[model samples]
Target: MSVRVLLVDDNPVVRIGLRSLLELDDRMDVCGEASSGQEAVAVASRERPDVVLLDVRMPGSGGLDVLPALTQLSRVLMLTYSDEPAVVSEALRGGATGYLVHGAFQSDELAMAIIDTAEGRPRLSPAAASVLLQGFHGGGTAVAEAPATHDRAEPTVVPEVVKQHALSRREVEICRLLVAGMSNGDIARRLFIEEKTVKNHLNRIFAKLGAANRAEAIATCLGTRRGA
Candidate 1:
């Protein structure tokens, strides 16, 4: 089936270009377009597109501002020209489904991104990956549980709930950021990844944590922290 999509950006030219580029792919369909956050929300609600290609900055609602509004509408791919970590992190925290940079990908890459976005994989600009890698490990050695020094033996078993979907190192990193209240954009900035990549990481985290939303994920991790 063709993947349905919506374009949300203030720039008519950008929207037109994206529409043309995306329409060339037989597997993708441009169902609608909205020039502002409010318009995007309204149109998305009505059309219920499978994904939204969103701009990072808009007139009244920046990428961060329109996030909550689009939560129920569709998966969002934030497109921006800036690679600033701060901006990336904010979008991620606000719950963007993916992040992309304008002019970062060619037609094929963009097509692949549309496919991946449907599968819940995040697509980021190549440079964003390097940024995220730096952010992931730069935060000092993850505080591991210390071995029992006295008579008591430390539990070696992974928690029953979380054990079902063992979190990878990347998931762990994303979890730390979520618990820290960093937006996906911010996490992307800190990690030097695109905000979209952060979203992908977060999808893994949600599965591992058995969480439906960020708040639940945070609470689950924090609950464990209290015991640790």
Candidate 2:
């Protein structure tokens, strides 16, 4: 079955371009389009799409304002121009399944992101990943000042905040790998555990950390949240 997607952006040209790009993929079906946050919610509630491609800045209620509602309706992947660490962190905290900065991904990558998000996997573009890693490293800067690659070196020791969360040793190991940008499959292979086992650990980790998603969990662990 084709993955139903809702395009939410204030720009008509952007929506049309995205629709045209996504239509090239046989696995995607553009279910609806909305030019504002409120309209996006109304259309998504009606269409019940598998995934929502959301823009951060809109006229009335921006993407952040309506993010919580949109997330409850469907998996949301932020497709925006902003790559600020704070904005990325907030969007993740708001329950976005993935973050992709505009101009940082190709059409094929966008299609893959929609599919992955619908399948419950978080996708981060290189720029977004850079922001998260910079936040993880306590670097107060934008993506332009950070490295362009997601191959940053993993921390040698887990942060004390993670210990405060009382995560088990294995869970700590998983969190370390996650901060290093390893996916569940990659972490599973690296730790010699099943992917399902990794996910189970992550669930417990998130619960303990009071995190809504992996990004939030990492932010909490590293104490990288902007106003925390």
Candidate 3:
């Protein structure tokens, strides 16, 4: 079945543009549209879309405000113009599957974000990823546009994943690199594994952590590891 999508943006023009772009992929079908956060929730409840393209600047109930609720029903990839660190951190905390700054994405990037979210692999634009790392780690910014390719630095020690989760040694290593803000390609090259292998490991990692995507995985790891 095509991945059903619900488009939520205050502007009709933006929603139409997204629909046109998403429909280009035969695997995606634009199932509904909503002009506000409340409307988006209502339509999403009725349509039960697999993914939701949600705009952050909606007039009445803001996107972040509805994010915790919307995420319960469908994968939500935030579409916003803001790149502020606080906003990025809050959206992820609010259960956004991915965050993409508007106008930064080409059609392919946007489609990949939606598809990845539906596949339970969170997609973060380089910029979005950079900011989140900064917010969480107080680390320097990530090169947001680093060619989707990039790295093992010093062996950052990761606490053992909860034994009940049954994470392997290599999975724990990969999770540490992910916390270091490495991309799939980066992680694969560093570990001398194929990119597809990195993705497969990530899928298993998410399952073990009870996470829906990379953002959730990162949050879960951070929440648990910080106190360790």
Candidate 4:
């Protein structure tokens, strides 16, 4: 199916340019446009596009302001020029499907981003991720900056599976770790199992849970809890 897209940006030129660029791909179509965060939310609610490319900074309501409201309408892909990792993290925490660098992306890259976000993954621009890594793990040492404002790619969604049956105890453990962003290697290490064995167990867990990925699996488990 063609990916229906909504363009949300204050700049008329940028919006028109983006619409023109994305239209080149036969799989993409601009179903709507909004000049502000609030308008974007309204248009999104009505259009119910497959993906939304939103600018981070806008008057009255910024990307953060309208993000949650758009959640019910469509997957949101942050297409902005902002380089702040804190902003990125907050957007993810607030339910953004993906993040991309508007200055650096090509039409094809944006198309791929739409596909990725539609599937439910968090994609960050490489440069943006590097900034985040530096801020989180590089200590006080500053990393070399990229000379140019380059385009970046981010995921729209991470594939998750559903639980079709009751989960086993071990499956619950895995689900918990997965929700916490623990990698398979980490989960295996904690469980005293080989990583390959963990993969096998996860396979069964997905099938039994009817989930496409760890997030869905975890959400299923959480739904059965007292306050989930």
Candidate 5:
């Protein structure tokens, strides 16, 4: 399936460059473009792109400020040059599907990020995750910067930590499997992904739960204190 993208950045040159690169990939399409936050929202409401690639810093009402509005229409991926942890944390809290550093990323990276965002996957770049993890662990200037998830009926399948860490739906699924005592290989087989991917999810899960290891993670998710 082709992913429809709404490119939102103040710079026309950047939008043109991004459109050029995105067109190189056959699975994605640039459906629209916007140069400001309000314009982005209006375009998104009309075009309803599967993913919105938004700049973090834009003139007049920054991208993060418009995030919630756009999210109501489609998933959003933050595209920015700022590597500041605080900025990354704020973007995540505003409900970004992923955060990408424009310069550090390549064409393929952007393509995959779009694909993942369209598929309801959280594409936290390693750099972004490092900063977010610090926030989760009280190291950030604003501690526990958990992202605000979209409004939906709270499912019975969701765990308590859902509100606190904004774990991806896949992450919550993996957490359920962990509670069932599934090993990494077992999770990989069940999820039909590589064990390496499961490991990566576990790392994110543990960090979000502020767990030192599996036991703590499970305990934390269940809202129980460790037996030790």
Candidate 6:
């Protein structure tokens, strides 16, 4: 079955371009188009798309303004030009399933992202990931934070949930970095390992935690920490 997608952007050209790009993939169907947040909500309600590609800015009622409603209808991916950490954080907090900045991904990647989001695996472009990481390091976002303690140098203790999954030490370390919003490449470099190694570890981590993706794994760890 083709994945139903709703395209919401103010620019007609952008909408057309997106439609063209997505149509190339046999797995995607552009179910509807909306030029503003209000129209997006109305169209989404009627079409019941599986995924919504929403722009951050429009003439009125920007993506964020209508996000809560849209998210209720379908999984939303913020496809916009803005990579501002604040905007990214706001969108994620507003229930966006994924965030992809324009120019950060190609058509194929976009198609894959839609599929991933539809399958409940959140996708983030490199720029979006960096923005999230920045917000996390600045201590102003939902990305996991080290437990509050007197010593700033104290290592982030792995959440009990992670341990319950019986993750290896290296897997726990990768999980910690992932919750911090670090990309696979960043985690690989941070741990002085090849990117492929990080991918392998992540696959193992996901299997152990029963997580579908990075976001789910992070959410599991963070939920445990927040409740502690």
Give each prediction's root-mean-square deviation over alpha carbons.
Answer: 16.6, 14.6, 15.6, 17.5, 16.8, 15.3
By lDDT rank, best first, the candidates go 2, 6, 5, 3, 4, 1
Q: Taking the tens digit of each residue's C-alpha lDDT, what string does model 6 give over 195-215? A: 768888988888877787665
lDDT of 2 by residue, 1-228 (tens): 999999999999999999999898899999999999999999999999999999987777778879999988999999998665556766776778889988888767888888999988888977667656654321112333433233556653346666677878888888877776665655777889876688789899889888887678778767885432
Worst 10 residues of 4 by lDDT: 148-157
Tell me which of candidates 3 and 5 scores higher on lDDT: 5
Tens digits of per-residue lDDT for model 5, 1-228: 799999999999999999999998999899999999999999999999999999976766668779889888999888877555546776776678788886777677889988988887777666687866765431122354343321222223345578777889898988877765555655677789977788889999988888887767766666674531
Error of 5 at 217 (Å): 39
RMSD of 3: 15.6
Task: Give the TM-score (vs. native) of candidate 4.
Answer: 0.56
TM-score of each: 0.58, 0.59, 0.59, 0.56, 0.59, 0.60
Per-residue lDDT over 91-201 for candidate 1, one digit per residue giving the tens place of the 0 to 100 score: 554566567787787767887887777677777775444444544221111113211121233223234434545767666666666655565655677679877678778
Candidate 6 regions with alpha-carbon error over 4 angstroms: 134-228
Error of 1 at 133 (Å): 3.0
Summarize candidate 4's per-residue lDDT along 1-228 as a digit string, tens digits: 898999999999999999898888898889999999999988988889988998876765777778888877888888887655545555665567777886676667878888787777656677556645653222112234422211322211122323336666677667666555454555677789977678888899778766776556666655542222
Top-scoring candidate (lDDT)? 2
lDDT of each: 0.68, 0.79, 0.75, 0.70, 0.77, 0.78
lDDT of 6 at 45: 99
Poorest 10 consecutive residues by lDDT, candidate 1:
138-147
Model 3: per-residue Cα lDDT over 151-225, one tens digit each: 235334335454657778898889877766665655777899976788889999988888876666776666653
lDDT of 3 at 108: 83
